[model samples]
Target: MTTPHPTHLRIHQLAGLKPGPKLLVTGAVHGNETAGVAGIERVLKQFDAGELTLLCGTLTMIPIVNPLAHRLQRREGERNLNRNLRPAPIPQDFEDRIANQLCPWLAHADVLLDLHSFNNPGPAFAMMGPRDNDSDLEPFRHEKAEAALAACVGTGRIVEGWLSTYALGLQRRAARQGDGSRQASLVQDPHYGVGTTEYMRSQGGYCITLECGQHVDPQGPEVAYKAILRTLTLLGMIAPGAVELADPNRPIEVLQLYEVIDREHADDQFAREWASFDEVSEGQLIGTRHDGKPVHAPSGGRIVFPNNKAQPGQEWFYLARPSDRKLKP
Candidate 1:
């Protein structure tokens, strides 16, 4: 774990005269995903320039959640902050400390937008985790309403079942290593989404993680900016035409995540530089195992979050398929 710089986490807030939904937007939870932070800055500039106005409720933005990591141009400082979002009696690491501090405000918000960017180049999408009837998501107990609200951001792509993938990945890893702690944790709270958005959802708020695009994509920041504005309009915090909707008929492409592939040994390697959303056929050779055996696709699907730099015991990529479910604008 690297020592973080002694910088204070800052939250920018804007309040309107009329009361409405409280919206929380977080950027740079993973420091490498900088576009979100830039997007927040751009939006703030618009507000200061009188180009955008808050008609009701409040807007809170945390431009850089992991400042030290951001400064170092790395993904994280100590550990993945997004993974340690669950409340614990004592903070476990640097990210845990920040999560604990942010918990109260997260619980109070009516909605949350967690901004992020993927390592593998791809189109922008909005990710929503599973929330069962018994889950802690209070106002968003209905999945249909949640899907509609998420699609309102106009990202045009929606990802589902991340929690299941996370659990499946962990289960396979644990099974191979004969470990049980992660499995135990999953059993204890199956709904825990393992990210900032998931933490917000657990606190009875509607939270969406908008993956703008590849980390350094030029269009990433602008996409994030538009998403925030669209969200404000959707929440009725601003006039309908305050921000021109980019796509009048944005059709959300819903994907069901089913598998997460992990690099279990140093010798395991991907066969090619696969980008996110790259489609693969059944039995397609995707990589090579530690013993030089070929690794093939289990089914026909698209690969996402593929990493050429994956480490042993870490996720290398995920597999998903398009589903009939969609939210049409």
Candidate 2:
């Protein structure tokens, strides 16, 4: 096994023959979301002719960023590995230390693809900036950006909002609405933000996020692998049409990444088996704290990814707004 140092987190790289641009792909920033790791593993194993050509740029692949989280099969370091990217106190927690080293690499990329999986059964989708989200990929880059996102996602469901606002803002002049010509979904806040992908865009790079599917699902990792292959194909980093792909259009919904409920202690218990996208009744008891206190839903909505093996302080469950299925967005 190769040791991953801060300077070289890249597990593999197929530098292009013609140095045009750099396309970086990362996986397993979150330990439990093993889909990216598995996806990259398959890509590495399937070495064919012209698998990753430096046709236009260099390709770098980092399979695991948070080994600690992977070791425990949980999200890493008390703080989410995606956040805490700002210039912070030099000496801090494990994630911060890693961020201090990694954030720069993410920010410095020319084009980056950060792979992740969700707790819920999710359609493969692309997560981008707020219409107001600032990014280095802003201005003249909207068309290509949208096209890139569109090509990566089998579904049309794209994410925008606070993620673009907070982390995405770090890259550009400041994401203000009614500016760019591209009519992207102007989201104020979606669920997750300040993640590594957002941070990369902040540093003047083209970065996109891919949610492969439910993390624990056996096919989840394979789906992510397909995503990686497709994305590289779109970027012209590999042979065109290298693999057959899934073309599925999903309804677009702004995912407001809510707070995570963890189930570390044995005392934590769910009221019932919650399914992904299950409709919920307001004030219904979703689960109980380790102390046996009732945890209820605040409103009538859908339950997103509901994890049963969350670490004591990590996210165990999440809330989501289900599509009415009547109104088309």
**Strongest candidate by lDDT:** 1
TM-score (C-alpha) between model 2 and the true structure: 0.68
lDDT of model 2 at residue 76? Answer: 62
- Clash counts per candidate, in order, are 0, 10
The clash tally of candidate 2 reads 10
Candidate 1 on 66-86: residue-level lDDT in tens? 887787788977666776476
> What global local distance difference test value does model 1 have?
0.78
Q: For candidate 1, report its TM-score.
A: 0.89
lDDT of each: 0.78, 0.62
Poorest 10 consecutive residues of model 1 by lDDT? 183-192
Per-model RMSD to reference: 3.3, 9.3
Local accuracy of candidate 2 as per-residue lDDT tens digits, 15-106: 66676657677888887888889888788767544354446677777898876667667776445677545545764556656666676666
